[model samples]
Target chain A: MNIEMIRAAQARLEGHARRTPLLNSPFLDEIAGRRVWVKPECLQHTGSFKFRGGWSAVSGLDPEARARGVIAFSSGNHAQGVALAASRHGVRSIIVMPSDAPQSKIDNTRALGAEVVLFDRAKDDRNAICARLSEEHGLTLIVPYDNPLVIAGQGTCGLEIAEQASAEGITKADVLVCCGGGGFTAGVALALEADAPCLRARPVEPEDFDDMARSLASGVIERNSRLSGSLCDAIITPQPGNLTFPIVSRLAGPGLVVTEDEALHAMAHAFSRLKLVAEPGGAVALAAALFHADEIEGEDVIVTISGGNVDADVFRMALDKFGG
Target chain B: MNIEMIRAAQARLEGHARRTPLLNSPFLDEIAGRRVWVKPECLQHTGSFKFRGGWSAVSGLDPEARARGVIAFSSGNHAQGVALAASRHGVRSIIVMPSDAPQSKIDNTRALGAEVVLFDRAKDDRNAICARLSEEHGLTLIVPYDNPLVIAGQGTCGLEIAEQASAEGITKADVLVCCGGGGFTAGVALALEADAPCLRARPVEPEDFDDMARSLASGVIERNSRLSGSLCDAIITPQPGNLTFPIVSRLAGPGLVVTEDEALHAMAHAFSRLKLVAEPGGAVALAAALFHADEIEGEDVIVTISGGNVDADVFRMALDKFGG
Candidate 1:
């Protein structure tokens, strides 16, 4: 992808994407044995970093295409992001979601003015339905991860981080971001590596998946199907996207995998100390920083808290696990 | 008592207190039938507006007094606030808390490096304990609300709201603040009324402790012993304070009372829609705005979310009430 395209996307998303606070936590700093800064995208509109790409992709369409509207397939944050973004721009949005998607996400998407079409993952194909909807309605398909415009939108989060850290006199740090299909981490790495040359970007994953880590070691993109039974549903994708894999390969400095227990612990920590309602995926980077403190000790670190859209049941489960 | 003293306290707290976000909620606006802005002090360090006063009071002590340390009595946010604030200033703090105070607050104060001295409210006099501790340790007593320094610190929150609203092109609005002992509301009123002459400041109370409302109607301070069995522990005080009453009387426009159900519903709404963890007391103002939509229709309004120190058990109970 052209770097200038990403910059243009950032420009288009300037006022739309929230310039979320880069909060400092002395307790977290102590826990990580490093100076810790959190970029709270969890506080972003639609409760996630998905809004960056959702707004970017939707807003970049030509007026005629925008008139036709947009469609996306997701069971989580991206659905709400697209719905909210499309509504904000006065365009219709159609979200194709799995039947088992959390009720909260479904309600939130519909509340944001989206037409939600549910398909059973056990009995039907979500991608095929989304494709059919896009074609039938003449709606532009805005893929959550594979699209270039989406990656560019996600990169705006990194731009904000670099600007905030620089303003606070922080010139160098290790940045940890949670990875699923790598859209968020890829975008963050590209922006941080380009603007803050001294900073190192590490993409973290659930130990169950770790496809990016495997792919990085093998010098080629690889797919894994062992991503199951994890508390972090949002980052349980089986493989990194083709478009994002290359960007991740070029920009990410290292790869780390954390246990599900670590993610739950981190989520609890965030709720108790920071008073933030971070979803499991959003807490993964901070979890890695805290659980693997020795590796990043004494370093200035920035963790991206990517979303705050956990299902009530999932949150309750996490609370129970952590003895809240 | 001196205006310059408040200015001096502000200067002392320049870099300490967080300039918390003033979030504009389109969802809340639609629900409240008005333009609503949330001043989220719940996101402040120690998860409350009390931190502003705590930090300011702790940091303002002379070197000799700082060396001697400080003492305070609180069962909730104020306890954590003083503990965290004193820790930030490297001053030792002793907190006299009710033994029945939530474990989260107790644990948090201990985590912040304060000595926790638990007392049974029914059997022990907390004030006597604090006095004895202060005398024994040569520590300065930091009263939570009655002190001028603490009031000045609390006023800084109002100062920030005024600046944030002005920056957002909101020249004036009716500001609703939840009242405990009246420090927070009085401080907010003072700052907003002084800085934005057209802004109206109103105090909100839980139906059980409608002391501010009764006082306003009677044109004199009134004390009540009736305690409403409600979830908002932070603002369930029996009456307004001597120091805070005069300030509140001079600056506040009117007082509003809201039901316990309204407070709980607001807490759930904030959590689900805004993704904010607001304690019940902190949400009471928003609750009034939400439940009393007709009273505030078509008006520009701002509500203060005073804290986010709700216990996990309390949160679960409230969520159950809201059918979560």
Candidate 2:
């Protein structure tokens, strides 16, 4: 929660994470009624922003902890991020993924040299399995969101955006980020507040998991259905993390909810218009901007396109739904 | 046509044209029956390698010629590339595009501050319009290909690939490039010959306009029908350029022809597995590698993914065709 810690993390991650291009989309600019800048983390190594956090966390660990390696529980982008980062650092990685996770995700993790243990989300507890693995192997548990280092690491993205925007003569932004455990949004808010103080940060979520939005309005943590099948598989968690919720509650702006259809439409639009392959979760923030254009009229906006790791079959289904 | 001139062009375009990433794909490597390295010009500015030629041609012009502006005629990626490069150089650009050009491309060109003059490709002479514009406005005609400067510019891509492959312990490559006016293939061949003497370059074309293949086999220039309504819109020209043909004849090893279905499948595979957006013409070389794996067996291979500028409707059709 320390702003200096976030700044230090940004300094630590300089040159390590790609300074992903802030691509201009005149097509999106025309449609949005304002200039739109896309921070394409989808082009990041491991095909997601999660790599930033994973790399930061792993690299910042004490030598003893680093020697023990890392463990993470995720079914998608984070799994790849940790696996790739750990492999790059010559550290072993153990990933606990749901049994129903897409074959592509599992395969990518394995390709990155991670040891994947599949758990049935419907019948077993992922966290318990992850804990067991961490304990058994004496590995450091690298939680996907709740850890302080992870949040600070994710903040580097916002730092880059602020620097890039300033260089482009942009002093303010209505920043939209897709929210799951609130880790990404909280980290981004902290960085924006520290750097581009005038910028506003908002978290966008699927209608099915509107807990973050509900929590923001009530100023309290909230939980949603544990079994909702949201279009954004990456952000379909039931609740925001405890550590993230506090930082988000104190620093984050209001949250917006977009329907599954809107997310699909945004994904198709991004793929065709911007020539970017944004996964459903990554497209959610842009979907909110598009679906609620009237609300954001005349504002200079920056949308964090989070990842590009969707299964081919799921990508086709989304494209079909959006008539692309 | 001079190899040294092409090398000079590569030097001039060093920092201007992106040394686009030469991505390694394990899946593609497995399918290619060799180590597969992809030169992703599809990720270049304006989403194609044409930007290289456009930049080189415009930058090499005398100051007075540059001040007078430039003009081109095209129905696809070339229009946007010229427009964007001209805008970057603070020069006026007039594009004589066919009325049937994809609306998205036309709009993109206009957005880059180019003057778009539309003519019916079937009923009117596009060259005549371009000539008249040049005469009236004193504009420099920047031919898309069939010009020495343009060929030199496109050669930079091949130079980058050869250097990058060498860095990765690959000294030789069976390079596959999609051919249109033979500009890209010729440029690539010149660069490969200069940088990696052991490398062999092959141009791949749609079966409908297999002039390059026939000409290479028969040792004579051959003309074919101007292919129309093909998925590979970017490379449907009737023949290789007069300047480029001789370079290809002297440097290229062979030519390959791919089916329309194979190109679409490659596009989809790029989208799904490689996380790249590849137009049909851009995917043709990859299609040849995938479909003709037996022919290219055990060879270190590099495919130039030329562009990523497909219409939304056409992309959807390709997705469906590939079961994406």
The candidate maximizing TM-score is 1
Listed models, DockQ each: 0.51, 0.41
- lDDT tens digits, residues A1-324, model 2? 777777877777775666676766666777777778788788777788998889888888988899889999888888888887898889999999888887877888999879999998789987788788899889998888998888988888988888878877787767888889888898998998888987878888988788898889998888987645766888777788899888888877788888888888888878766678888888998887777776563368888889887766677777677743
Where is model 1 more than 4 Å wrong at Cα?
A120-128, A168-171, A226-230, A295-297, B1-7, B226-230
Instruction: Report how far residue A163 has shifted in candidate 1, in Å.
Output: 2.6
Q: What is candidate 1's lDDT per residue for B124-197, written digit by digit as tens?
A: 98888888899999999998788888888888888888888887788668889988888888788788776776
Candidate 1 yields a Cα-based lDDT of 0.83
- Predictions: Cα RMSD each: 2.5, 3.8
lDDT of 2 by residue, B1-324 (tens): 766777777777765666676665556766777888778787777889998998888888989999999999887888888898888899999999889777877888999879999999789988888999999999999888898888888888888888878877887668999899999999889988888887888999988789999999998899887678788989888787888889899999788899999999988778765677888888999998888876663468888899988876677777778843
TM-score, cand. 2: 0.86
Q: What lDDT score is found at residue B138 in candidate 1? A: 96
Runs of candidate 2 exceeding 4 Å displacement: A1-19, A57-69, A87-92, A166-169, A190-201, A225-227, A249-252, A289-300, A321-324, B1-19, B63-68, B87-92, B107-112, B159-171, B189-201, B289-300
